[model samples]
Target: MSILASSFHEGPLLDKYNNLLISHERYRAMFDNIPLAYMSMNENAAIIDFNNAFSELTGYSCEEVYMKPFSFFLYDKKDIEYHVNVTFPRFKRNGFARNQPWKLKHKSGREIYVIVHGNVRYDTDGRFIQTHCLIVDVTEQRLAREECQRAESKAQLILDVISERVTFHDREHHVLWANKNARSNAAPEC
Candidate 1:
């Protein structure tokens, strides 16, 4: 018999319960398949769950992280202390913390930057139960920022050369840029 048909004969409570289970499964599927790193911790700051993307980024399996103190992955002593001792406690008291950029050491000994949003979930008696994290790896973004800086430096060097008039722009039919050597060798008119 169809599950919905069975629930219908059982009563509204059964039908509602079945629907809730289905909804939870759907949400779980979406979470597991997400392309970004996702992690969750207990109120005690112990890692409880993480997604596939988290493993891909960190080079650590979910099994290695689960039930362990998440602070173990942090290479910065100050950051580790702040996150485990200060931030989680403040979040438990505050209910939520917005996106905060963090630097962490990966299993390969490379430092990666991530933006994290955390929220504290509470039990019925108002005690903190879990901390949920939505983490996004920003290593590529950091690299891009550095690349832009280098490109700006190179452009400045080109401008400095141009500003000295050591380079010349020539046009008759087509425009051409010539360096000091090329300009000195080219015919004055042509």
Candidate 2:
């Protein structure tokens, strides 16, 4: 009877241990399999750990980036300054920063635009431990936005050079935009 009771107690403990191990594995798999680039850095901003997505985005292997400062990957000095002076302070104070624009230097020597989200972690004693980051590549999106803006500016210039008055109105009949000639040729109100 005593032996049977001891075995039953051990079974539940073993099952609980196995469940803990499975949970850890699941967490690690999810971290690695996430589509966006993910990285963890030490308090000094040195690269400590990174997921496969980060390796793919930067075209850099873990060996190449291990223990390197985050600024080592930056494409511009101004960006480094911004990170140090603005982003870092805000992140430290608030424990998080969202959608911060960054330009990183790729292994192929090209600049890649990214929006970074970062969260700081603290130890049980409330001491800063590390920062975890998620990075979304925005190079294509930024380029598309710039192209659209340039096209709009060029169309506006064409309208300004024309002799005819051109006015753009919204559905509410409010003037959105008017060419220079249209603005100048407007009649005085009755």
Candidate 3:
């Protein structure tokens, strides 16, 4: 006859409520144990929490980063503004930001390139309380792109020199890609 007893009698609703709680717990566990670097920060940009992958990538223990200002590791002043003013505000307003590249300096003073995905969490009143992020180191990808550009430039130079038509075929039937003078002298028939 009591209200509490009546609620328990609502078996279908109780089952749904229990299922929702279980689903939420499973989601939280997955978020916390994800393989990539995951983190959350307060509105002041202080690191509130991070996962195991974060510690592994930055070489900092969880205890060391907790409550620390996220920008403390930013060696470049430009990066501080870029993250705080531009990236953070937009992310906080939009609820999500993705693949923003950062040149992050570690505790050991090594710089690493990382692409970050972030989301802002709001309290019941719809006020922003925390920002969560997932990070992936992209230094190798950036380096590989730069190296490919350099090699392409070198190959272009070789092609430009070969266009001069001054070189000739070698005795082994391979084209001698040399200076214009050598090609002109060797292949006078052309």
TM-score of each: 0.68, 0.84, 0.67
Residue range 58-166, candidate 2, lDDT tens digits: 8898798888888888999998888777877778778998988889999999989999999999889888898989999999998999999999999999999999999
lDDT of each: 0.80, 0.89, 0.81
lDDT tens digits, residue span 89-127, model 3: 788889998888888887798888899998898999999
Residue pairs with clashing backbones, model 3: 166-183, 166-184, 167-183
Worst lDDT run of 10 residues, candidate 3, spans: 159-168
lDDT of each residue in 1-190, candidate 1, tens digit only: 9986776779887778899999999998998889988888887778888888877878888788788787887769999999878887887799888877788889999998988888888889998888888888888999899999999778656765653544444565353554554556657785
lDDT of 2: 0.89
Worst 10 residues of 1 by lDDT: 166-175
lDDT of 2 at 134: 93
**Per-residue lDDT for 20 in model 2?**
91
What residue pairs are clashing in model 2? none
